[model samples]
Target: VGVCVIPIRYIGRKMLARARVVQSSQGDLSSTLQENFSSQRDIRAFELEQQQIRLFRDRIRRYIQASIGAVRWQSLLTPLIEFVSAIAMAATLLVGNMNGMNMGDFAALATAMYLCYEPVKKLGAVHNKAETLNAGLERINHVLNAPDDVPEPENPRSPAAWKGEVEFRNVCFGYQQDSPVMRNIDLRIPSGQVVALVGPSGAGKTTFINLLCRFYDVLSGSVKVDGIDVREMSKKELLSHIALVSQYPVLFRGSVADNIRIGRPDASDAEVEEAGRMSAVDSFINETGEGYSRMIGEMGEGLSGGQRQRVSLARAFLKNAPILVLDEATASLDMKSEEQIQKEIERLASGRTTFIIAHRFSTIRMADRILVLEKGRVVADGTHEELMASSPLYRELYNKQQMVAEEEGGAPC
Candidate 1:
């Protein structure tokens, strides 16, 4: 019995190491497949089919090699234990003969030894299974034990009322500690004001909204909503008061009604339809003959970009939050679609604190206040007419956009 355990222990260690490698390689293969599947359109558009195929094949080869290594160690364990057991049985027989034991006594002793060896053999298999389970747990724990970059407050506060008033007081922040993306940002926005953020690419436009949503804590100073520090409020509670319509809206595999109902889960069917109608989703949806019941594919497949944006807009309308954020919300729409949705957006923005981030002058013109940002700082803040006169950067951006629109035979600002 003791001799049999020696081979099991040695092979068990080798199996454990190989099992870890097998799990890691399997994860890599899965990640590659998921990414390739999700970006199929881009792959075909850029003529990257062969390159992607080669990459996937390489990962598959590595996964197969790792799996074979683990199997080899596992297969070796049982056979080696069986051989050790045979040697032990032979020794027992020789000892019994030397001590002059009768055939019946030797037979009984051999049966008892065989019974003990059977359990030991099963233990080796159980050990191998245990190692495989441990490897999977290690991977799961890596994600489960990861640190939360933004943590919830222990004792959260709720305001008496939500007024949608936002203020940034000497706020400074950066993705990295040493380099600041936003510096000394001090601004006060009254409730129910329509504010627009204009900037060149990488000018911290998205980051500015990210901070207002409390996606990340500021490096210094504070951001306040209705005279309450955002850090003191529960993230869930704070987010409940705001609705965001992003540039690239994500839709799930469900009916149109289901996606819109995500904004307010308790919303009734009639309410969902009303919101959809307001956002112009009803126009095309009714043409399908299924209306709100029409099923959507993953990531809004089978739907045009404009249709997807309207669906996202419906969600925001259904939410009816006091604060509204439109991050290039109409970017995917055609001129007519943009004009139509722009009207609904204006109606929705009434009596709500609204923030718009857009490059189109037509959209920027709707804002009561336009903030021109450059390198994370607000270089200009005023109405569109005010910025055109005061801010060179804002003027240059508008002029360039005007030229591009003219070249494309679209309406000029």
Candidate 2:
């Protein structure tokens, strides 16, 4: 039984790995198909994948338990081994009585046999269960006790006001160990200035923004807002002074009014509607016949990408913060929607520090200054005309964006 238990433990672990892989693969397939299908088709594919994974997991669990059950039966066989020894003892007694031999010798032989097998069998069963449970407990603790890579400061101060000055002092950072994403970066953004961050993918545009928001800390330097190190400020206090609009804006399941209200929860219905009007959202909201009361399903499911972006812009307008960060906020909008949203953003950017991360050269041509990042370092910093005149890399990116805009049947940038 002790030897058999070793094999059972190995088999159980193999089954557990197989089950985990099967479940994970099914989930991956569902997510991949979801990216390409309509809502109805996505739902059907997800349901089918879910069913297959559930059946596969149940079968694996049942098979592993059945293997355990067989080991348990093998363990119970030790009792039967004892019963056999007893019968042998009884035969010895009968023979002893018939031949006038000792009965005490037979009883002693039976007791010794039981003691040899019983403890080993019970110990095997106990060890088998303990090993299986230990594997499960190890996985649970790993997720629960993992430390945060970015932690809040122990004694943090709330920022009373942000003068909207952002500074990066010799910042160095990387997602991986040794390969720096951004290195030796120094930047100064004054209050009420619109600055554009333009670079190719992996050129550290997003990483720069992450550093500003303190999503990830710098390795060897610091980011300061209004002359105060961002790390010294509480997360909530730092965030309240900034409004961010992402390329993919996440809208909850609620009415259009409710979505705008997220920016300022205490805002009245009339204020929400005013934001919509400012973003030209009122036209679409009224046209859809739902007015402001129209529902936006999970993640703004029923709205077009442009529409969702407009709503997000409206939320930013409603927030009315001293600083705004736009991460390709207008990348999805049509010319008309872009024009409307750009107008609102420009209006909002007045007297506020705005960081615009844009791939479209046409959008950022009006930025007060553009910071060109390459391999996580600021290689060029100037106005559009100045960068085009001085930096070859900036010129290349500007020319590429102009070509793209021309291909889209628009005037060249």
Best-fitting candidate, scored by lDDT: 1
- List the candidate 2 regions with Cα displacement exceeding 4 Å: 1-141
Residues 345-395 of candidate 1: C-alpha lDDT, one tens digit per residue: 999998999999988777766789989889999999998888889999999
Clashes, model 1: 0
Whole-model lDDT per candidate = 0.90, 0.78
TM-score of 1: 0.94
Best by TM-score: 1
Q: lDDT tens string, model 2, 1-413? A: 33444544554555445444444454555565454353555557667657655755666665566556545544554455455556655775677688876668766765775575666556545654555466556566888889977677899875566678999999999988788999999889998899999988789988888888888889988999988888988888788788888767999999999998888899999999989988778878898798999999987988988889888888888888888999988888887677667777788888999999988877786699999999888999999889999999999998888888888887676
* lDDT score at residue 182, model 2, on the 0-100 scale: 92
RMSD each, Å? 1.9, 6.6
TM-score for each candidate, following the candidate numbering: 0.94, 0.72
Deviation (Å) of 349 in candidate 1: 0.9
Worst 10 residues of 1 by lDDT: 404-413
